[model samples]
Target: MSAADADTVLFIPGLWIHSDSWAPWAALYEKAGYTAIVEGWPGQAATPAETRRNPAPLDGVGLEAITEHYARLILQLPAVPVVIGHSFGGVVAQKLLARGLASRAVAVDPGPIKGVTKLPFAQIRSALPVVKSKKNRSTTVALTRKQFRFGFGNALPKSESDALFSRWAIPGPGRPLFEATEAKKTDKSPAQIDTRLADRGPLLIIGGGKDHTVPEVVTRQEFELYDTPAITDYKVFADRGHSLVFDSNWKQIADYTLSWVAAHRVNA
Candidate 1:
């Protein structure tokens, strides 16, 4: 397909990072005749270094605001695009699907949604750096390299994990984390998802086996929550972790995702 005829793919980054995190995957998709748009959450700094230097801009941002931002972006798109998101972004992608905003969607190691009930000890420990401090709800919170290693890069070598943390880590708003955990507390929570919608489109949930933040069990439960089994699928990278998109083997995951999209191409 030529660039004009190619499908548009919107790559949504997760917490603590900017859209630049998707540069590699975006380049790969463009090379394969797709238009890739990498969108950062609202108030994200242009670069990780800048974000680390000043994170106050992200404070007080919540799931509702972030979701609405993406929803508006999708509504303005020239065509219904394929949405791919990781971590928190994954949950937002599902919310977009619920709104009938995507032609297809892929969520990688997505954060907990409304219907997922299992909360593993590892997951709790991983989020403790933020959740343990209520003050973080109004202030930006950044994870230590140690915390990142434990939560996102556990499957990688220490040196690599450290490097990735230094390069991509930044402060993130804490309200979204609180909202995700407290989703069940309210009937009209922003984290709520209607996976059974007939127009929800094709959905793929990808899990990282070694992920402490959102383990395989969590992603599996998310997949099972969708009543339309015919349009929902799940895949797991047995040796990966929450940082699967930034891991050394990220290309493998990217290629697999590309293949999945091609298989479910709207006009294929």
Candidate 2:
């Protein structure tokens, strides 16, 4: 099909990142024959300067709030569109799906939601820098070199990591991490969605084998727990890390997702 006949593609970013940072990927999706839309959370300031000057509440925001924001955005679409999300955005995608929002979805290393039982040690440590400090309850922290080395840099070079830190790194809200960590205790658990939304639509869980934050093992288990008849596909990139979207291998991953949507998503 031509671009004119394709459904729009809405790209949702993970925590600590902005929608503008996704411009390149949006272009790629456009080239693949879809009109692309990149959006941010209500409180997500545009620049680091803005974020520093007016930092928002980290612990105050809840899942329902984020879900509502995306739901509103989804409603503005011409029709139900393919949703692609990463990390915390992945959790948001799950929330959208539970509400029967997306035509299809690609969740890359989605963070655990409530009711998810497996929390890897690496994932915990990657998040400990924020949750460990009481003073950090309302704060956001940039990933340190050491932490990135462990969580996101295992498969990338120091040069690339440094460049990404300079270009893409932003202060992420601590609230979602805290909430997702304590998701098991919450009523809107991952299990609740997994159980209730068994046949909402197709879901593809993409994992990076070298991702320490959402380790491949943890992602695998999360997939198995949640995958139902609606989920029609899955894949793991052996050498990729958590920052798969910007990684050199991202085109292949994006292409795979585009192909999946082409095969499954019905045009309006």
Candidate 3:
């Protein structure tokens, strides 16, 4: 098909990772005859450097705000598009799918939602910087090099991990982390996704074997939660960590996503 007539794919980035990190993925999608829309969260600056210089705009941005922002973006498009997201972005992606706003979705190492009860130690440790205190709920939290290594780059070499941190890391709102970590506690949590929609579009949940933030078990639970008869699939990168989407081997995951979407023949 001509690029002009091809499907659309919207890329969403997680915490501490800049929207620019999706540039390579967007290039790949555009080359594959897809309309690629890559944008930062509601309060994120135009670039990572700009966001780091003044992250005040990102403070107090919560899951509800993030989810609604994407909802509006999708509504403005000609048709519902394929949504791909990692980390907290993944959480919002699933919520979009639940609302029947996406043609298809791929959630990579998505954060814990309302029904998920699995709280692994590493997951707790990875979120401690933001979730440890209520004071952080209304502020933006920066990831230290050390914390980034543990949460996003455990499978990568120290040099590459450091370089990735230097290039893409930015302060992210703490409200989402607080909402995710304390999801089950809320009576009507915004982190909940209705995974039982029988007529919903296809979904593929990817998990990284060494991901500290959202472990393999967490992704597995998320996939299983979809009792719907609609297509729901799960894949794992056995040696990767949470940084799989932007790390050196990002093409592997991107190519896999393209192939999956082609094979399923999901609609726009």
Candidate 4:
């Protein structure tokens, strides 16, 4: 499709992996006549290998900083793009919508935002590795293979889970987690969502039924927060986990998101 006719879809990745995490999704979006751009957090290395080898690049990064980086990128787009984000990137997508930056947004297994009080035991346990350390706020931390298996890859077979961990797992900034944990106490926390905004574009929240990180409970709570359910939608992929984007059934979710965007394209 020509640039003028093509819709831009910006893919925002969450913790651990960089922009490359969205490579497969980008290709799919492009095949559907959308111009896809996979962007990373500020200071994120180009690849998982590079970030694994040197994590200092992500030190001291926080949620607000990452949000600002993405907001700036959205402002530079030719038109308001369809912003799709996974994990913490999902949180950023909502922030962008609050700023009137996206034509539409899809948040998959999104990290919790302020006012989302339902923190399940699984979610807390999954985040313990990062939140356990106060110094992690200023450092980069990598999850152990076992931790990755439990928190992100539990729904997949051992071989596939191991392969995904090897290919995509990398050090992630801890400050974002810290920021999320303290969001309730902080005014204007980055995790705060402006659910009351009437002009905020349509949003779709996708959840994994078996997800240990951002479980269905969390996604449901997020969905209920929207004052206008007409523009907000939620779906759960049963048998999937936090790593749904990298799972074999990822295309199913992608196809749904594409259809949702197509349905709402007239607004763009």
Candidate 5:
């Protein structure tokens, strides 16, 4: 397809993650004939050194700010892109879809949004250290081995999980975690991803069977909220966790996503 005709693919990372985290996946999308773009949150640069050296807290950063930043970037793309988002980014993808930004979206273990009534113990515990502090707005929380094992590595081998922890793990903003905690109570939290714009495009929700942070049950439950008849799909990786996109089998996941886009894109 011509440059103008070929579809674009944008990869948005989760909280405290940098664009480099999606480098492998971006190459995969490029090989599949899709232009790829990786975006970060406002004031959130996609670099491990910067993220680690001066990790910022999530205070004052609300969902509206996030949505607007991504929306403006999406509007600048030449072609409507297929957004593939992980964790908090998945929530952002849902919100973008609601506003008609993309032709389709893939929410891989998206973070809790408004009205999601369930909060797993593991998730709460992983977030306790930061949320307990009232001045946590400026604090950063690093994922310890235990925290990663329970929330993101229950199904992976220790070596693999350990490597991931050492390589990509960094401090994440605490505000979103705190906001997501109260997402069920108020609509103002940063986790409020409105999948209500279900008709704007097709959506695929991928669940990590062992993901304590975003358990399969909750992922499955959230799928039902996309009430539109716009061809929503769901899948669960039995041995996967929150790090599904970064796993060794990521190629398979990427292939599946590319196939879905080819089948449902605007120019398909």
Candidate 6:
């Protein structure tokens, strides 16, 4: 099919990362014969600077709203789109797949979901500032450069880490981290997903071995949580960190996702 008549790929950005950062990935996907779209969360500003200046709208935005936003968008699409999401977006990608919205999904370094029990120290430290108090659940938070370095850019040099932060970082809601951290204990948690959907689209969960924010162990646990007969796969980048999505070599991850989607969606 020509690119215009081919499938659409919806790209979802994770927390603290601007939606516009997905532009490069969108171009890459379009070149591979797919229509690409990247959207921001509910109440999110169009640009990083605008959102940084007035983040009030994003303070209380949580997974439910974000999920609904994408679901509504998916319904209006020309066809069931292939969804690829990173970090919290990863969580949403799986949720969308469970809800029968996407034809196939690739979740890279996704946030911890309801059934994940293991929380590494680095994950805890990265999230403690926001998940420590109940009030933070309704507030917006921005990561410090140092925190970003540790959680996302640990595997990259300081100069590139700083550049990525300056270019793509933005304030985001804290509810996801809070809800995910306490997901197992919360009733009707937004982080919950139906892992037993045997007829749903295929899923590929990617992990970053050097990811401090969402450790590779957590990604494996999430992969293990699926109890269905549906296809579920997991892959790990042994030397990469959470910043794999937007770092200098982000195309590596994007290309892998493109290949996976092509292989799996053929039977989806």
**Listing every candidate in turn, what is its Cα RMSD in Å to the true structure after a full C-alpha superposition?**
2.6, 3.3, 2.5, 2.4, 2.9, 2.6
Tens-digit lDDT string for candidate 4 (1-268): 1122128899998888667868889999999888999999988888888888888978989888998998888777777788999999999998887777787889999999998888899999999999998999999989999999999999999888888899889899999899889988999887898898876778899999999988899999988888864488888888889999876778888888989888866342
| Model 6 lDDT on a 0 to 1 scale | 0.89
Clashes of each: 0, 3, 0, 0, 0, 0
lDDT of each: 0.86, 0.72, 0.89, 0.86, 0.75, 0.89
lDDT, candidate 3, 1-268, per-residue tens: 2112128899999988998999999999999889899988999999889999999999999988998999999888877888999998999898888887887888999988888888899999999999878999999999999999999999999999999999999999999988887778887798988878897778999999999989999988888888989999999999999999999999999999989877776543
**All candidates: TM-score:** 0.95, 0.89, 0.96, 0.95, 0.89, 0.96
> Per-residue alpha-carbon lDDT of model 5 for 1-268, expressed as tens digits?
1223236788987864565778888998898887889877776645776767766634355556677888888777776678889988888888877767877889998887777777777667656766888566555666778777667767789888887777677777676777777777774566666655535777888888878778887788888776676778998887777878886777777888878878876643
Clashing pairs in 3: none
Write one digit per residue (lDDT tens) for candidate 6, span 46-72.
999898999899988899999999999
- For candidate 2, write residues 1-268 as lDDT tens digits: 1212236777888876666766777998888768898877657777755764575643345556677788888787656667788887877776676666887778888887655677778888888878897566466666776676667666788888776666666667677777777676767543245534665767888888889888888777767776456655669988888878866567878888878778776434
Off by over 4 Å in 6: 1-6, 266-268
Clashing pairs in 5: none
Candidate 2 has an lDDT of: 0.72
**What's model 2's lDDT at 151?**
70
Off by over 4 Å in 4: 1-6
State in Å the error of residue 158, model 6. Answer: 0.8
Least accurate stretch of 10 residues (summed lDDT) in model 5? Answer: 1-10
lDDT per residue as tens, model 1, 110-202: 999987898999999988888998988887888999999999889999999998998899999998888889888878888888877775578
Model 6 TM-score on a 0 to 1 scale: 0.96
Count of backbone collisions within predicted model 1: 0
Superposed Cα deviation of residue 8, candidate 6 (Å): 0.5
